[model samples]
Target: MWSEETPSLNNQQYQLLQELGRGRFGTVFRCLHRASNRLHAAKLIHKRHLTDSTDRRCLQVEPKAMTFLSPHPNILQIIDTFEDADTTTLVLELCQRRTLFDRLSDDGALPEPHAASLAKQLLEALAHCHALGLAHRDIKPDNLLFDDANNLKLSDFGSAEWFGEGVTMSGVVGTPYYVAPEVIMGREYDEKVDVWSSGVIVYTMLSGIPPFYGESVSEIFEAVLRANLRFPTTIFRTVSAPAKDLLRKMICRDPSRRISAQQALSKFIFY
Candidate 1:
């Protein structure tokens, strides 16, 4: 991981513009293609995150999802990908729009049109990945990217898996808050996990809080496993019935009963 003080890869040809932010595994910097002056986001992964067994798994799966989804307008662009002697670097499209996290923290609840727009962009990008037999496994506010126009883009699939006839579970992974109960419990899961996480994300965005929370992590996990969904009426009184209905379908505890992403795209509230 790069600190503002220490950038791992030493390519003097690449000019650093500024630090965008830091994530679990690394720092991202706004950079310029020295020769062309094109702006980009450069994701720098830590040497340990690339070499360690657990972190390596995250590193491996992230690129597959990124490369597969890179072409979509609703997905972060991978201007180029390269690995150094120590770290992995991705030259990416610079995103100017504030993160959904920032928006929710600042505005509390997003407007209906804004929520719908983000949800639509996310679903389309997700549908494209699912069609390619991939499972993002992790979907939350932090994973969504936005441009200067607030146009949505999907990012950070480090927990993704290539799910096909018989896929490998790089290991039980994903942030607990956004992870599906089945995946957390080590039960066999599929792309449906992403749908569940997306449900949580949408709920958070529209309602101004996550569907469930606890003073401690164990309680939070219990709530998720038991499907103890709650509503803070004060926060969601103005949300439409159609929106609530969609949330229920996406977050259904039983994967067998949950609506698929493609089916969700055609649902009533996909506006």
Candidate 2:
């Protein structure tokens, strides 16, 4: 729930268990709400990180987006929020399992069925975001977390932005491998950027590697700008033709030609 008044966040309300992970601005901890005795993930973003207007805008947008777009099974839900002079804490649903990135690191690639299942969930979540005028600028394996049931949940709205119909967003956002070509060219873009990133996720799931790569970040950007979508015969020999077709429609370099999240979700590849 959202409120104009900042509620005092104190140790009396929640018992911080342990650190789950760290991000650019905050440390996530496993916490228990004393009143309910229920477990939740608490991300305490320090005020010190609010060094610029951009940082502050992101801080404001993250919680607002989570609160407005959540209660979604495939999108991480925020239980509550708190504020103090030093920190802003977001109490979120606990997804006590590895991220999709961790699974990929350990298991290489997933079978088509498993990949399609997760991809569909991600797309559905994106569809929900786009419908609400929010663009998840950063969509990658690291942001895809799993719950106890291994359900895919899209998380981390630190880079999310709100856009209007027919309007475009500008910025060099998103992770290296999953960033869209339009973003790399410093062109104005829309929600389709997330679709491009999701396509990269699907490609990685099926082939065990990103379609574009480089020895350095610059090289990776160059490869992404080229936007050469390819499937190695040896690696993709077992992948079905429909899956490849779906990837082409999604990962296309041109945002105008790229399929929307809803369109990708309806593709036969998932069914």
Best by lDDT: 2
Worst 10 residues of 2 by lDDT: 1-10
Residue pairs whose backbone atoms clash in candidate 1: 1-46
lDDT of 2 by residue, 53-158 (tens): 8889888988999999978989999998988888899999999658999999999999999899999999989999999999999999999999999899999898
Can you give the lDDT of residue 234 in candidate 2?
A: 97
- Once fitted onto the true fold, the runs of candidate 1 whose alpha carbons sit more than 4 angstroms away are 1-13, 49-51, 165-170, 268-270
What number of clashing residue pairs does each candidate have, in the order they appear? 1, 0
Q: Which residue pairs show collisions in model 2?
A: none
Per-residue CA lDDT of candidate 1, range 1-100, in tens? 2454746457765776678887777888888888997888888886675546767877877776687776888888777777767778878889974777
lDDT of 1 at 39: 83
| lDDT by candidate, in order shown | 0.79, 0.90
Displacement of the residue 39 alpha carbon in candidate 1, Å: 0.3
